[model samples]
Target chain A: MTTETKPGVREVQADDIAAKVAELCQTATHVLPEDVVAGLKRAEQTEKSPLGKQVLIEILENVDIAKREMIPLCQDTGTTVVMVDIGQDVHIVGGDLHEAINRGVSKGYTEGYLRASMVAHPFSSRVNTKDNTPAVVHTEIVPGDEFRITVVPKGGGCENMSRLQIMLPSRGKEGITEVVLRTIEESGGNPCPPLVVGVGVGGSSEYCMLLAKKAITRPVGQQSDDPETAEFERELLTKVNALGVGPQAVGGSNTAIAVNIETYPTHITSLPVAVNLQCHSARSKSATL
Target chain B: MPIVKKDGETRATPPFTDEDIAQLRAGDHVRFYGTIYTARDAAHRRMVQALQERKPLPMDIRGQIIYYVGPTPARPGRVIGSAGPTTSMRLDPFTPALLEQGLKVIIGKGGRGSVVKKALQDNKAVYLLAIGGAGALLSGTIKSMDVIAYEDLGTESIKKLEVEGFPAIVACDMYGGDLLLAGKEAYRDQPALGDYVSVPPAEKAG
Candidate 1:
């Protein structure tokens, strides 16, 4: 099909994108978003265990220290994840979109003093990708002429706990809830609770996992817009808190500050559920151009 | 309880006495002073391999504390990047071997496996939890650091770090006192604020 030039589709250089991603990665790792900081403060106030409270307090103080000193919030610095919403009308100029994103990752990690966590091969060599390059990128075509990008720096400790399972439709909500709870229970204090649990329900297995990941990047404590989904989220949250897993898995009442659920249409016979938990850090940021 | 401030002289380190570790209990806040070595997955594996091969390990393992961390690169004038604990569980398989070599103390985040806990008991060691996400604040406590071995591993290299007032909590004590479990049990009966679910009826209830 012959393409027609649009009257107003903006042209954005790939280098600009690389620079932005680099900056965003650094910012996301170093700075705790205000919402996450608030969630932690709330956890501190409500935690019943004295030790858990102390931990929360220290975490908040750490945030302040990291901000003032321009240090990363956590040592892991995390695997760089980029989610781009490309404007369908706009044409990206200069270089390959994906390569540009990777370049940005390389610059961000190296200059930001972020840890290079990526291993070259999963099973064999396992060499470090020194500059933390090859970001995991997810893209979507959206309506506007503006390009939007979000960078989520996920800590390895928490990411290791993420789980996905295919459930028979017969299992339904209870099964989904059970898996989510089981994942958290298995996680214990490992993922650094007062966690943000992002659950993906329906869709295909891979897609559901993606949804779970995307859900974690949402603002902590924000719930689903769908009333039923929102209610389910609250119910699951209550049960998870009831697990008494508490902050840092150190135990207390405030195990998780929020549970965000996202759903998509799926095969009629399958219920693919994925649980992605974010530690108290829950670092992420978005920029639009 | 507010964090118990542990400072000069009280901080645990090399030359750890039973008295030093005995003074600690699960849930107690500690400010680690003196020196600790940094090691994580790769370093642990190498250490274990050296033990199996009966080869000399990089550093003397006796009465030493190891921090499970792979820190970001140091920026200009900074001692290190955000240096926080990685999950300890990944180091579980190699831990017992290290403990056998007289590894006395461990610092990291998360629950350790039962096998490692058994090792802690066998070796009379303790495990402490640094505030997991508080790398920035914790970085302040680090006075100096130098990679002593396995520099090729990059961030995962074993390094010698001297820290002052490095705050942490005694997660697992020498007597098998597990703070992670104890902390959970501390509030097991209590419902946190916003916990709307009521406990299920007791099984004995008619």
Candidate 2:
């Protein structure tokens, strides 16, 4: 391999990553972006039920409280997760990326009053991380000095309902629609209706998961740039709302406010799609620096 | 789905005894009227531990129904804040223990898991599922939490509530009957006209 060095590139320290993570945790939890707030307000208008309408209003108020007090919106607090998109021009210095992330998560959770939801093991002796350390960190190296960090806290209910599946290409649009509709129907009002439906399409298993999650950050009602995929998302949206799962599934109308789909080209032999359901709580915040 | 106000008059299931478990069937539209306790995952654990140790329970669970809920903390002078049923699956492991201590009814959103269904069958208990995510509306049914145990656990702490006409659906009955399956079966592409065998209350008591 040629050891070609690009001049003037800066190296980032593990401490820098840690500090950034910590700050992100608190800031994201406190301030919801203007786009999201606007989307929720629009959703408040669209929700039909008297109870559902009231819950949406309370959510708006809760965000106001969370921002004003710099505390978490819900008691569930949530598991700490950091998604970092780093510039290729920079090199990390001082320590491991993972450790820096964990440290930042540790400091942030402790100082922010967010709950520590991580467990040492999945099966036996489920233990709390206390300070919500050891976050689920995802890193991607891309183009400029700007590193973007999105700190999202997902509660267990919506997390439990997330699903991924592989389908025969022959099933095509119709089959995929069925799977997605069935998933939401079976989910009922449990995922906290009027949810942002994140659909990941045309990837191997893991890529589908990444796409599904990353899809959330796109502004609440925006569509995929790909026309064909955007059309598919629109189709899924129509079918899902038709189920009348309503807000909280008590029944009325409008189970999901919107369905967003993100897809990529894949091998002819394989077709995979995943769905990640996010509740109205949709606690997420990001910083670009 | 029709809307019913809090103070509206309707058919209700008054507090019943252990023997009354045999008289309710799954899928029965129910409106619970009485004092019901609220306990979710953590409180359920503490309650079961108390029962296992033969220690005094925080409240009298005999013939009492527990609403699996962890409500948002009540604001000052407002009886209670958003209170709604959480998923029932999380409390399945602790159910049998509480049932052994005479726990008769468990209410929540989702249907009970296998162990909870088994416990309900063996203990002659019933499971009622409230509407999920209707927190604000559900809270209106609860007058107040008369007593709260384990204050430090915050929302998950045990709460003794006096409710009047809390609406819910009978999800699972004691005689191995299930309503979740029935409802889905009855609902179809054209508006379901499906049928399923159910052990009616009269058949159950006999």
Candidate 3:
């Protein structure tokens, strides 16, 4: 294919994208982001139960060991979720975008010695896809000439605990709080605490779920830019901690480190909400090409 | 001998007797030594199926401990990699049956269901909680590993593991004490919100 001659257009090689993605997958699984580490430290200080404090200490130690030894932070290394924001002015040369991403995922998991958690058949055979291929990739076209890819390796334990609901608009903030609290309580110790909860409000069902997932990709302590949303996040975080599901659900005052909320305008009759609970590992990495 | 310390941390080896299990209480810390078996969702399902068909199990599980984990592939010159616990509740259905067969201890992350708790109480077994997501640190405790059965299952295969100073907490004991419930009760700043709020089912779009 001939290269486009448009001015200010960036031509990026598909192979370079694959290489960067491969490096990111390995690095992200090995080292947690700094913000999450800080959150865990804060949890250790704030935890009321002695046992909970010990658990947080161990968790922090584990994080350090994982980074030092270059091993995965968690055994569930998880399903690779790749989110790409491609600039409309950039041209991807040499291969299909998705194929390159999957190639990168396969290379990263196999060469890095990460677990192959993906199974080929969900219902019947449930066979393991040994290489952990065909990552769940989401792509969006944006205004700039920059291409950004964020890889989130979501573990099944916490991902399974996530929930979404279409609520009556009348339920409002109280209803949303109740749903978030119920998810955390019912989840108990399964999702691993201290959790970073992501809440999505006021969109269609599927869109809200996406929003919740995106909310988690944001840094742990950063709040919503909107003041009202930030207040809601703080309020939800308080009630969730009050549930006393504590670190590892052994009960403590620091059940969750942060609550992040994202909202979108929706139909008058529906108030769709989704809660995505992230374990203490909370691993994600992004790179721009 | 059960090595119960004043600090609530106990050190014990597997092939534990009822006396050893009896000495443990919910919320106490434990450091395990010697051999343990690794199993998770797939391995448990197959073991339960074997019991149903009246076939001999791949190994003698009597008086043994099962750790719910699926570790990453070990790199060159390593015995294991990131060996942390998976959630235990998924094995709840298969656990009671194993406990009935003389399985003495279960090691994993998270809480067990009522049926499993009753089984532990009746069978004098116990459940231990390992640190979830703390895989690398836990890997340091494991000295060696060998796959004994169902190698084709990849990471889900049944393996024999030799560990030293493997840390965990007593989550459920034979005396009906559950740390998950008790700990949460102690730390809760306010009463629970009673029943969960019910949301109406979504309407099908035309």
Q: Candidate order by lDDT, highest to lowest?
A: 3, 1, 2
List model 2 lDDT by residue over A70-105, tens digit each. 435554545676788889777777788888888888
Q: What ranges in model 2 sit over 4 Å off?
A: A1-6, A68-71, B1-38, B42-58, B63-85, B92-206
Best by lDDT: 3
lDDT per residue for candidate 3 within B1-206, as digits (tens), equals 54556565688887878887888899989999898999999899999999999997888988788999999999889999998999998999899989988999899999899999999999999999999999999999999999999998889999999999999999999999999999889988842221222123221110
Best by TM-score: 3
Model 1 local distance difference test score: 0.83
Error of 2 at A240 (Å): 0.8
Q: State the lDDT of candidate 2 residue by residue for B1-206, as single tens digits.
A: 11122443333443556557776777565677768888888788887788778899888787778888766545456676556677787788988888887888888765567888888899988887765544545666788686569876666778888787687766788998876555433322311110111112121000
lDDT per residue as tens, model 1, B47-140: 8888889999999978778999888788899888788888888899999998888888899999888899888888888898887888888888
Would candidate 3 be rated incorrect, acceptable, medium or high by CAPRI criteria? acceptable
Clash count list over all predictions: 1, 0, 0
Model 1: per-residue Cα lDDT over A45-137, one tens digit each: 887787788888888988998888899999887888899999888898878999999999999988888888899999999988788878999
lDDT of 3 by residue, A1-289 (tens): 6765679888888898899889888998999988788778877877778899999999999999999998799999999999999999989998989989998999999999999998898998877888888799989999989999999999989999999999999999999999999999999999998888989998789899999998888787777789788777777887888889899999888888888888999998999999999999999998889
Q: Which ten residues in a row have the lowest lDDT in candidate 2 chain A?
A: A244-253
Q: What DockQ does each candidate score versus the true complex, computed on alpha carbons?
A: 0.35, 0.07, 0.37
Report lDDT (Cα) of residue B179, candidate 3: 98
